[model samples]
Target: MGDHALALGTAWAGSVQAAGFIALPRRELTAALVERAGVLLDAASGTGDPAAAGAVGRWLVEAHFTHPSTLEHTLTVLGPALVRAGPDRGPAVLAALARGYAAALQERTRAEQERITAAAFVARTAAEQARWASEARFGALFADAAIGIAIVTAAGEIVEVNRALCEMFGRPADEVLHRSVDVYIPADDHEHRQTLRAMQAGELEHARLERPYAHAGGETIWTDIVLSLVRAPDGAPRFIVAMIADVTERHRLETSLRHQAEHDPLTGLPNRTLFFERLEAALEAGRHVGVCYLDVDDLKAVNDTLGHDVGDHVLQTLARRLAAEVGPGIGSGARAGAGGSGHLVARMAGDEFVVLVERPADRPDPAEPLRVAQRALDVVRRPVVSGPHRIVVSASVGVVEREDSASGSGELEKAADLMKAADTTLHWAKKDGRNRVARFDAERHRAAVARFELSARMPDALEAGEFVLDYQPLVRLTDQRLVGVEALVRWDPPGGDRIGPDVFIPLAEESGLIVPLGRWVLSEACRQGVRWREEHPDTQLFVSVNLAARQVREPGIVDVVASVLAESGWPAHALQLELTESDLMGTTGEPLDALPALAAMGVRIAIDDFGTGYSNLAYLRTLPVHALKLAGQFVTRPFATGMPDASGEDGHDGVDLEVLALLIELAHTLGLSVTAEVVETAVQLERLRKLGCDTGQGWYFAPPVPPAAVPALFSGPVGPT
Candidate 1:
């Protein structure tokens, strides 16, 4: 067994040496492996645990035998020897050894990947450490290492060249020793010459860079070169010492990794990262640029009906078509200058691509984006044939152009804004109808930006008391007596013009700020109602506040309303919650279920803008509704000026009047009161009263006024003229 182990160990050592980069001596490595193999042979003979053979695998790795073929060689030598030693347990021992080797290799591979990830930042530190270690062992270790070294005088002539350096250039010592150091460097490498001059002049202690050197064999060899200044005993610059390690393989790997990082693997197109890099560079150079952002419509449907493989094929086909049709220089035009004058077609993400056109400052073509967008659309509309399936798809593109004169805070910010504008325009294209191109509209973008600003500031505005409510009185149509006041929210931003609900309400609703804003409105209105009732104990006035769809659907909406009423000392019956007819009719589940619970608490629920929605009388009968606010369209249509009477005289259509009358009668029949909205003229008011409308609220009563102005209207009937 001892002889067999020694023989196997000798073979293992030879195999590892052939694999290259061995850190241990042949004799020492062979002795260690022989002892490990003896233990493995014992394990196979059942004198020791078979798993103990795993340690031999670990020992091989620790000794720096990490070549890919090292394990194969170790296994070949050990497998047969162990089985011959003890046929029964040999297979188990071999399996244990293989698992250990694989685990160690996997761990080492993961660690190497991590090291590569941080290679760029750590390269200088590694070079510095290598220099220090080499200097500490300058005499023997310096000459023996695979690293190339050269000692040069302050005059830039090589005084001595190590044997390793000569071997590195594929030349002998005598030929390289007397040559100037510049002879080994590229002639056009002015930066390296300047750095070496700085070191010789005592301006710098050391410098590190990775550069390529010419080999005698007509090949380029990349090296991590560290140049250090050697000072004399008097502290004057004496000689320069240069140390270089062969990094050709590492450089190749880094270049490949960079390509992988900046490109979409499947499409082989530049990715979002590289696109933004080029876009920012163009903007920084004050170049005129345009971007066409595209999105594949119905991609999800394709992914669902056909497999993801087909979906991927579709994307790949689109990428190839876009690259072919809308590649660099497509829209640069004749005036494009050398600087920033080209185009880049990149895949931004799944089913999305962007084509960037860059032109010199002298050339500004606003229409370039539209042309590129049209071309992109044309290409995407072409049918893609994947195996067994013919897929036809369209893309919506948003186009944005930035002229050289455009002002922005910074290049990165400008690039981001351009992308945002492109994305927004793409949405417009999709919304307008897919398969079309939409150019960025400045006016529309400004409005959208303003809306976004408003939504973003809403929560803070509410918290800061920047929002206030104004009361619009709802009065009886017959006597013009004050019945109730609807609370309308207004944004009274600090040091800014008061903004009406028409502008910010939808913004609030879209952002979900309506829930909290609605809560604030309800609480404030209830408190104001309680105060007004205290001042006039005989009046039975109610306060109506509109509820947004989001608020109505809130899980704890009933609790929120009940808590507000309890905190305000206001009567629930005197508080009417109004919801638009469209919103009320579409509600289901929790929202619909909450209405009855609210009514049970003596809170009145009214459907506002009643005539505008489905107006399903049957559906209306099922809800716990107390009142209906007739939409202004129905009430004002008959009395509206210049409206021709088709079926009647006096500029009023008989059909319009009949519709208004029927709405009022139906509300009464359903045990609900009716309120007419937008009654601006005396004629409209008289007609509403004659039609038996229970109440009316509009500019005719009063525009929405502050809390103090509301009490004056309560003092008099203010009957219609």
Candidate 2:
């Protein structure tokens, strides 16, 4: 058993060495492993169990023999040793050993994958630390590494060169030593020299750059050069150490990967990623930049008509023609000049492309962008030939230009903003008619930006409690008595004044935020109404909350409303739910159907902004509504021509009075009361009362006030005078 173990361990060590596991001496490693193998052989032969074999595998791994070949070689050597030592049980023992080693190897593979993932996560910071910590090993690595190495004085004169460095440059040591390191750098590569200068001046501690070096045979050798500055014991600068790795094949692979990543596979045009990179560079260069965003017209229609194959062909052909007309080696009318000014054409997305032009800072030309836009339009409108098919394709272009400033400040417009404006302008061009160009308008962009900001902040605002409700009094138009208060939701964003409902309400409704938002308002209004009712038992005031169309359409709206009423302990009759005319107009939907069930529970329903919608008065009769809230426009339009006299009786002319009277009569005939909104002036108030409006609300009584001020408004018999 002892001789068999010794033989097996010696063979295993040799196999590991062959597999590149030579960290320790062969004799020492074999002697230690033999002792461990003796224990494994006893267990495998006696018990026929693989536990000892697993232990041996772990021991091998701990000694850094974890390569795939190490396991293969271990089994190959140990199997034969077992067979020779104990022929009767050799095959069984060998099988157990193989299973144990394979199991442990699987664990090692998983551990190694995890280690690689962790290493990649912190590679940059870890690399810097490792480079600095290995200073003592640097001498040995520099001398023994297969790659090239050189030590140069701070003045850029080479002081020493290793054999590998000489072989890499194809030159003798005598010919390379004492020469300026800059001789190897290409003439056009001034950036490389600047890096060296920075290193010498201590502006940088270490740097790596892939650059071409002049070889002895008049050929160029691409190398990844890692240069680090060495300092004296007292911290003064000493010399520069450079490690050169020949990365010709690596460079080719990298270039191919970059091309694949940055170009459209089908069209072979630069993609959105590359376009933004060029745009950023142009912005950084402080040059006047312009972009002409283009979209192929009716591409989807073409795809649907003539299968996608021909559609793809059309795009490819168009791309080729566009590139041929306005790219390198072709007579592209638009070109770039010094100061990093240039033109780049890229595919923004499916059927959309953009041509970016940069004008030299010294020559700021306003007409350049217009000329490029016209040229691009002309190029795309030409007919394209995809195989046997001749497809006529046209495109719309949106052009945007920026003025060059000495500061190159991007505070006003950034790359992302610029791209968005171009997109909006492109949409404008498409709307006007395809096959044309449109320029960005500042006012239009501002409106779009404001809408976007309002929509984007809605969800966060709701979650962060940026929303609150203020109450506006609804009064009986005849007696000027406060009947109820309408709960108006308002957004008071952080560090900003209150944003009115007009700005963010429609925004919330459009973005589907009204469902959750409406529920919150319902709960809050009910809570406050219950408090007010409890405080002033004599007052029969109720809370009127407006519901958005989306809120009405919600399948769970009935449950949500019931939950709020139950939670707040507020009477259902004291809560008036207002829905827009359009919301209740969906005569056959769940919302209209749900109204009767809610009204039966003592929840009064009213059609708000009544006459502003296209819904007929006949449809109003079908709704389970108790009141009609005439839109503010009907009341305000009467006074628009001129206000009434001091008596407030002569505000409305013939048509205004007739319209208001007829609507009220119709509402009364349908068994519904009428409410008038926007009664700001006494003339408006007296006029609404004469028109038989049941209740009125406006700034005349009180603007929407916070919840804390509700007590004061209801403290008296009537609201604010």
TM-score of each: 0.70, 0.58
lDDT of 1 by residue, 588-675 (tens): 4223778889999999999998877766778667889999998889977877673446664446656998988988888899899999
Off by over 4 Å in 2: 1-258, 280-287, 295-314, 317-342, 374-398, 402-408, 412-464, 493-496, 586-597, 641-651, 712-721
Off by over 4 Å in 1: 1-220, 224-245, 265-267, 298-314, 331-341, 349-351, 383-393, 404-413, 423-434, 587-591, 642-650
Q: Whose lDDT is greatest here?
A: 1
The TM-score of predicted model 1 comes to 0.70
Candidate lDDT (C-alpha), each: 0.79, 0.75
lDDT of 1 at 646: 63
